[model samples]
Target: MEDTDFIVNYVKSKLITINLEILIAKDGEDGVRKGQIERPNLIIADLMLPKMDGFEVCQQINSNPKTKDTRIIIMSTRNSKENVLRCYKLGIDDYLIKPFGLDDFEQRITRLLYS
Candidate 1:
């Protein structure tokens, strides 16, 4: 997951115990680098990231043959239809609006990882 400290910590506390290897990125560029290096099964990003931003990150990941199959979940407060469409255009697997509860987050992750 590539986001600020708050979201990273929140997800870590909620999901780390479940054996998910949570990776933290402070911004979009870092996230992309880590995604390329780690090749994690899934990536959760926020739209308003420092540097490149989530859309660009998703585009890069999807475009790369190595990471094309990696599922992307964008989490952000910007839930406007336009933003959602933009993310879809970039080939995001799913999205979640900010302030999501633990159950909802867990369910989404589980569905993506297991389905």
Candidate 2:
């Protein structure tokens, strides 16, 4: 799977600098559970994960009445056309490939959060 400590820390720092609240999940299951409980505005997830993969997590979140409207961004190394298409079909707001630039990532976050 996906190891997201760095990504989480990076995003967390950026969000914190902007005075935004951030929550980090331990794994895919944790992510879904937290999403349901926290009802956050956005969720950035990795495609590969323990317990459950990101696709399942996304499906669960999308299927839930409480979190169906939540915006999702898939941040992963899986950059195949099929993967991107699948994410869009699942209604994900955006898909970011691995090793993304911080500025681009921040811009996407800003656009989603503000626009």
Candidate 3:
């Protein structure tokens, strides 16, 4: 989940009946830590995280054998080609721009999970 409480709660509410167990990370470091321990099938992260940015979080997760295969979806307000390309290069499965609609996010998640 993202660092902001509002975003996290909003996402959780939108996915209320999705049958997926959701976990929240306090920041990038916690995200990486939880990824290693929980080994979730998917991860949704924000670009501007405290302590470490999303890029570093991606590197940590990707490099770690325990969580390297986890699907990642990065959300950011940057909307820059370079950032998106960088995330792809880091093996993220999807990238979402900030202010994205919940329906669109759901569609992306569905595609990522079922495709």
Candidate 4:
């Protein structure tokens, strides 16, 4: 779901303490495919992904019956009003701008996973 290794590693580092299984998808298509199969409780995706964008990724996963309940958090550097509003309209649970802090990230994850 995440495009860069740094963010992925950061996510892993943060999520490790929570004991959640992590899955990596190389691209948007891969993310959708894996989500259909794994149906994880939550998904965190980057906006400017290769092969497909975050918006499409959210659409496909949200539309799929198997993964419809999966909580999604969209991450992007561009926190435009349009982008954030679009993500919300697509039924994404939350959105995060890039360079977010560990505490904020953890809080959001906990909220989505537990709420």
Cα RMSDs, all models: 1.1, 1.6, 1.0, 0.7
The better-scoring model by TM-score among 3 and 4 is: 4
Query: lDDT of each prediction vs. the true structure?
Result: 0.88, 0.87, 0.90, 0.92
Top lDDT model? 4
lDDT of 4 at 4: 95
Assess every candidate by TM-score. Answer: 0.94, 0.93, 0.95, 0.97
- Ten-residue region with minimum lDDT total, candidate 3: 11-20
At residue 47, give the lDDT of candidate 1.
91
Give candidate 1 misplaced runs (Cα > 4 Å): 1-3
- lDDT (Cα, tens digit) per residue for candidate 2, span 1-115: 1456777887777778777788888889999999999999999899998888889988999999999998899989899999999988888999999888877888898899899
Name the better of 2 and 4 by TM-score: 4
Error of 3 at 30 (Å): 0.4
Task: Score candidate 4 by lDDT.
Answer: 0.92
Q: lDDT by residue for model 1 over 4-114, one digit each (tens)? A: 787788888877867898778878889888889999999999898899899999999999988999999999999999999999999998989988998899899999999
> Which regions of candidate 2 are displaced past 4 Å?
none
Task: Give the clash count for each candidate.
Answer: 0, 0, 0, 0
